[model samples]
Target: MKLLFLNWIFLITVCYSEKDGKHLEVRERLKTALLQDYDKTLIPLMNSRQPVVVELGLSTMSMDLQGDGLLNMTNGNILQWKDARLRWNPEVYSNITSIRIPASKIWIPDIQVYNAVNYGENSFSDSLRNPDRHLAIVTSDGKVLLYTTHKLQIRCDVAKTVPGPGEVFIDRGQLDWPWGKYECEISMGSWTYSSSQIDLKPYLNRNYIEYLDQNNSPYLFTEDSFKDENVITCTRFKCCADLYQMARFKFKVEKRGTVTAQGLKLMKKDDKMLLISPFLLFTLVIISIIGTLFTISKLCHRKPNFLVE
Candidate 1:
């Protein structure tokens, strides 16, 4: 009976793997279609005379330098159209609400921009773009998204436009997840970001957000039914990474017809850090032992030696 049960388990595992593979193929195809559609529809909007400004609300940022964990962005920034929980000291917000154009007669309303994130909750009303400090872009649209100095970098420039759509390539940051170290590449104009080695498709659903660790292997759904049993709310994982009290955020799942998200999640370092290489750990242990021995020796030498009598 035990052997039969083991065999049954093996078959289930194989079946799930097959199912996951098929689902991944569909996701890739959908991503490609979205890219094609975006290229055909939105590329022309880049030609406007008014500068396009991207506002990535602080709520979506993965790392908060300030203890607030949300952007009280004190710069020439704009408010997001959607409501967010980020607190603002009137003074700090003053810097973002509006920008002064030396002699220009126009005042642009700060527009909220998104990085096309899929794994976690990233709200449309966030106060900062590319909150994880992992994305960057350059474009002919003349839109700028404000962020801290540490995260600001040029990833690509809009070279030219084509009949179908303009092309854009942005740099992605190195993410250290349980899988390993790899770089992510987000191609903006095409509207797809891929880290072939990461395989984030498994965590695309709401229930699996924070629950996706090495253990408790969960399954992913093949279809795009937001009302599926897989959709869930992840509110218990909120934690902070910043030291200065300037940023803050919250998380919630939106269930209308299809399961969708309407809020942002706060950042928290996980136990993945515990998975450092054995060689690195060994080196640290050796250094610690040596330092302890040296301290003991110094203390013994300073004291009177009774054994010398």
Candidate 2:
């Protein structure tokens, strides 16, 4: 009896040990599978170095009287100057070429010259009056791009004249009003510098400022020489207005980081079952131990011989 009891205990110990080993193997397998899935989904983003195509939209207008004379002196006529230019820095990005962007991808602003004096003036009157005016995109040494070479036509408005004593006019009235709008698209291919990598996290929610420089001069937009210095800020994939004077603009980066985050989320979700219910696992272990013990007892105990008459 003593020997039988000892054998039963030994058998139960062996069986429980084997069950624990199997559980550990299963846990390891699950961990490996999770890692494999993560690699398949997110590893490409970390290793990829391909060039990306970026679309840039620019729109701006300027209305400055060319000469020193007031609009009223010109009898409701004035020489208004409207100009816009696009530029970039070559050191940060390369291979900046103009691509033919489709109309659907371009945001065409309402190019209109408004005048309070003329209530029913034709909208296309300015374009027709100035047949030479046009928008052009010029590429320079693969560094800068210029858009809207021709000047815009704008009409001025003059205030009503009021007669005073001695035939003197109280107010000559206001001269031509300044108003114009410009919208255009430029496409460029870009990649990160070989020595540096771009971190898109900070720029995701905020605008990135690009300083401008003249194509012929080294002076930056902030300098006094570049009086028309305008800064362009890129929000996401779109940049509008005053982009010409900026030295460099930021391009929208792929959302690979977001993809990686999503992958991690999925991994956690898939492993949740294993991580959440420790109590259930404990119950399984207990049941396994009980099963092993019962098997061992049955094998070790000999059935009592039935003395049949």
lDDT of 2 at 15: 100
TM-score of each: 0.22, 0.17
TM-score between candidate 2 and the true structure:
0.17
Q: Can you tell me which runs of candidate 2 are displaced by over 4 Å? A: 1-96, 99-107, 116-146, 149-309
Please write out the lDDT profile of model 1 over residues 274-295, one tens digit for every residue.
3335566578899999999999
Output the worst ten-in-a-row residue range by lDDT, candidate 2.
Answer: 72-81
Give the range of the ten consecutive residues with the poorest summed lDDT in model 1: 189-198
Quantify all predictions' global Cα lDDT against the true fold. 0.28, 0.28
Tens digits of per-residue lDDT for model 2 on 90-166? 23233333322121222122222222222232323333233234322323222211123223233322223446766
RMSD of 1: 25.8
